[model samples]
Target: MTRFGSRIFWCFVTAAMIFSVISAAFPTKAEAITFTPNFTISSEAAVMINLDKDVTVYEKNPNKKMYPASLTKIMTALIVLDNVEDLDNTVYEAPLVVFDELYGQGASSVGIERGEEVTVTDLMYSLLLKSACESAGILAYHVGGESISNFVDMMNEKAKEIGCTGTHFVNPHGLYDPDQYTNAADMALIAQYAVENYPKFVEIATATEYDMQPTNYHEAGWAHIYHTNSMLNRSSSYYYQYAKGIKTGTLDESGRNLITMGSRDGNNYLLVTMGSPMYDADGNAVYLHYEDHKNLYEWAFENFEYKQLLQAGIEITELQVKFGESSDFVRLVTADNYSCMWLSTVDTNRLKETINVDPSLLNDDGTVTAPVAKGQKFGTYTLTLSGEEICTVDLVAQDDVTLSALAYNFDKAKQFTSSIWFKAALIITAVLVILYIIIVAASKKKRKKYRRVKKRRKF
Candidate 1:
């Protein structure tokens, strides 16, 4: 071939290779979309979280302090569950003082006569499902070891432990008190903790109706304790199929409050709404809490989906491997798959992944060394939404990289020779050897001179 033709052919090949690399590095961009829910709600304060990832999906005045109403029983239940070791066997009696307080304050009750005997498990049903103020007092008095106030203190401490910063419990029944208040965000955290640590709490809260058998005081058995949260009652007009157990609260000062968990399409969500209007302008009662919950659930279900961001065994990124036996680069993958809630309508391109490698595992040139084991975690990949990290997974070696013995030894020798200590030692040895030679030579010359002088004297 002619020289010019050969040069042209090679030039075309080189350009094609460069183009291919560029395309691989930066694929075609997808149409960008913004995340902005187009729904409106009437709850004064609200927050929703994706349970699987613990990411906040929606918030409306989440941190604003407001009354939690009967929702306070959630913490009460948690404290009782923790303190009460035996639920089925341990029995508690209602103290007359508890009924006096309930009747005086006009708080709701499940009609427990003074000295009425009931099991701890039955009281839990009454406390959570029926929002029985008297039942809360009974549990508190007994679980608190004769002091309901001490139980209230435990409730606050548990709230703090659950990372509730804006919550303080003045009473276990969630009755109105100037000092008793919580924000939507804090309430969500408390609920999440209960659901995660206590599965029995979920079981009790989700029940539509629980029949309390005849106790010592009443032969006909207490009225069938029905759940106060309408979302869990299938017969209610506002019933939601996905709704799970939580609690409801209401007061003249706090309005209506609800915390509920819903699962659909493999996604579980916890929602908390507080301070909905109790009555409309007509002086008639309003059930805006249910409306707000239903709206939020519908919007979330329609717009959000669980997206698998990283799959196990699929290469995520390539890391340079120094002194590797088979290849100069190693592939990084996730040891387990990572999934997160994402907007179904938004463009997938909006999701960004940021990789952070450990400095200790990287060489001076920003490359990993040989002998990397198959599941070695050397870095992390964080998936983000608008610069906020939604999920993070470990970046692991995709396969084992055997160390090249020759290359490893050569690198070790080169490093040792280049090190300051080795250089200093070498310099010191050379100086010592030179000093010894000079001293020996000088000694030998002196001995020769002495021998010659002696011979002259003899002559």
Candidate 2:
């Protein structure tokens, strides 16, 4: 090939290399709102999270304090399950005063007779499925050492333990009290705790109809109750197939509250809606909480999926190395796998990344020093979709780069010599030497002139 031909080829190659480096340094970025709810949520506060990935997909005033209503019983059931070891074997007798405490207050009940002996299973089912006020009182009275106030204290304590920040329970049965209130986010955490920790909790929460077995008070399936949540019922218009057992809360002040979980095709999500209007402007019954959750679940199930955007141990970029004899640079790869529930319509390659290496690890010239070990974390890169940060993963050394003692020492010596302090020292030393030489030269010249004067005797 001619020299001119080779020159043109090298110029093209240099341009391509520069372009590649620039592309990696500044990635293409697009910001799109991936999580958009299909319908307006009529609830005042709500949160929907993908339980499988633990990601918040939609939220509206999630932390706003609102009345939890009957949803407070979810925490009650959790405390009961925690205290009761043998759910079916242990028995507790109802006190006569317990019946009097719930009498004529417009509280819901399963008609427990005074002084009736009941098992833990019966009370649990009744408290959860039936939303029975007396069962909650009896369970709290026994579990709290016969003190109802003490049981509410236990509920509040458990609430704090499991990360409920804005929740305070005054009663276990969720009777409307001005002091009792919880937000959607805190309630979701409480419900999630019960769903995750207790297996039977889900069984009871999802049961459409629970038969209160022949007890000392009731006989022959006479005391059966259905779940308060309409989403779990197949015959109901608001029935959703993927919806599972969770608690429901409603009160005059609180409007309506619902905490439900949905699972479809290996994806599970938990939703909590609070402070929804029970009746529309026409004064007709409106189930906005249930419908909002149903729409949100369907939107999540249809549009999103888990996609592996980045894989670990794959070379992502190369970093120039100083004092490296074995290799001029080291390769950086992802430290861990980053899989996201990305939009199905978008391609993973379109997702932009912004890489950042630790400033301490990098040299002044934008290169890293040697002595890098494999799997050593050096930096992080954040992935974004439509301008929203999706996830950040650590960047690690792909292979070990041994440090060259000769090169490292040479660089150190060069740095020391070029430093301001060393340069100042050198200037002071040179000035001192020049001054001493001038003084010595003057003294030698004076002595020579004196000798010449002494030898001349005639002058």
Candidate 3:
């Protein structure tokens, strides 16, 4: 090629490359929305999970282990409920309702007096409502058949069974034990399981006040009690109405810790934070914990929502095939459920949906196959909002229908025969055949002419 021709070819190639890059850079649609927070904290780990869909809406250093404090009681309550056959069953406190230096000298107590003879129900209230170290010890003792060490073993074993890798339990009340540690993510999982699996536990955790009359050991009366969870009380004025009872934890070493649960409309959310310095001269740690959870939850609920891109168990459309057994179409159906987030409550409609599929699904004539099976993966259904992509689900066959296999094979054969390469081969063969015929004809004519000339000469 000439120098000028080479230069022109290179320019064309560069232009093609630039065009391809630009085309790929711009998507056919936008992406999903992201939920961002307004403030930050010093806790080593935190997590917010949506219970309804079992999805983690926000997470930061969720897997690092920290002291759980009284939040460990939530797990204690859960395991006891799971193993015990009867909830209303009654039991009296063992000869122990006395405080000792080993009980963490002056720690919170349920005020259970020795020989008070409280019921199992009363112990639960004391354990959860007041963060009573004594109640925890007593309950652990009873739950494990008088062995506090055995009860702690049960706590650790249960934590592992629930898919928690970074958690261990030393005491039921979450008192500081060098070995007692749990991360925000594992705490969230434990909280999630409690709320999902046990409703009775939920009631106990959320209740603000309960009345208890002394059994045969003391006089009957009602006692006003408050939840240790700061989020539940309005007079504390956190402004989180959806806020519900989980549990809160605090210790000199563990700092301020909390596992809070709440719901707005149809969404149930869980927030877990650990290892925050509580009761600082700067502010109240419990209040700060409440603030963090409230803000994180408000941000998540405001900025995200579940948008259904496709209906469950319903067929959306079909694929087009060219020369399949059936002349015109193969059926297509949405594979599964499709839901995703929008930027905020204001932009729910901004969410968009698109489908992607294998090009081979279409025939040369751009037609679909018939008789597609139900639940077959026809394509992917993606949901996007704002400029960010949120979620993608599968589009599947909704129903089953089969077309004639022989007819599909015959149509495919026709396509193969009509291919450009096949046509070129046929053309080449025809030209060769014609050339052979012409040469034979010319040779015969030449021979005849020679014989005539020879004969004339002889005569």
Predicted structure with the largest TM-score when compared to the true one: 2
lDDT of 2 by residue, 1-459 (tens): 234444543454443332111111222222223466656888999888788877777789988989887888888888888888998888888887677777788887888888888888988888887788889889999999989899899999999999988988998888888889888888888887888888989888878888877767767787878888888888999999999878787787899888889999999999999998989999998888888888888888998887777788877788998778799899999877777666575677877988877776676798877777888777787787778787777888898999897987666566656767556656765666677779889999999998999989757
The stretch of ten residues in a row with the least summed lDDT in candidate 3 is 18-27
Best-to-worst order by lDDT is: 1, 2, 3
lDDT of 2 at 80: 89
> Which wins on TM-score, candidate 1 or candidate 2?
2
State TM-scores per candidate.
Answer: 0.66, 0.79, 0.67
Residue 405's C-alpha lDDT in candidate 3?
A: 64
Specify the highest-lDDT model's number: 1
Tens-digit lDDT track for model 1 on 1-459? 234444544454443332110101111112212244676677899988888877787888888989988999999999999988889888998898788777778788887789999889989999999899988999999888899999998998898788999999998998988999989989999999999999889999888888886789877655888889888777889899988878899998998899999888887889999999989999998998898888888888888876776677777888898888998888988667766566887676877987777776776788877777888887777667776656677777888998797987666566666767556656665666677678888999999999999999999
What's the CA error at residue 301 for candidate 3, in Å? 5.3
Candidate 2: Cα lDDT at 429 = 59
**lDDT of candidate 3?**
0.69
lDDT of model 2, residue 303: 83
Candidate 3: list runs displaced more than 4 Å: 1-34, 38-44, 83-89, 95-101, 104-106, 114-116, 215-223, 264-267, 279-286, 300-304, 311-322, 325-333, 340-389, 395-459
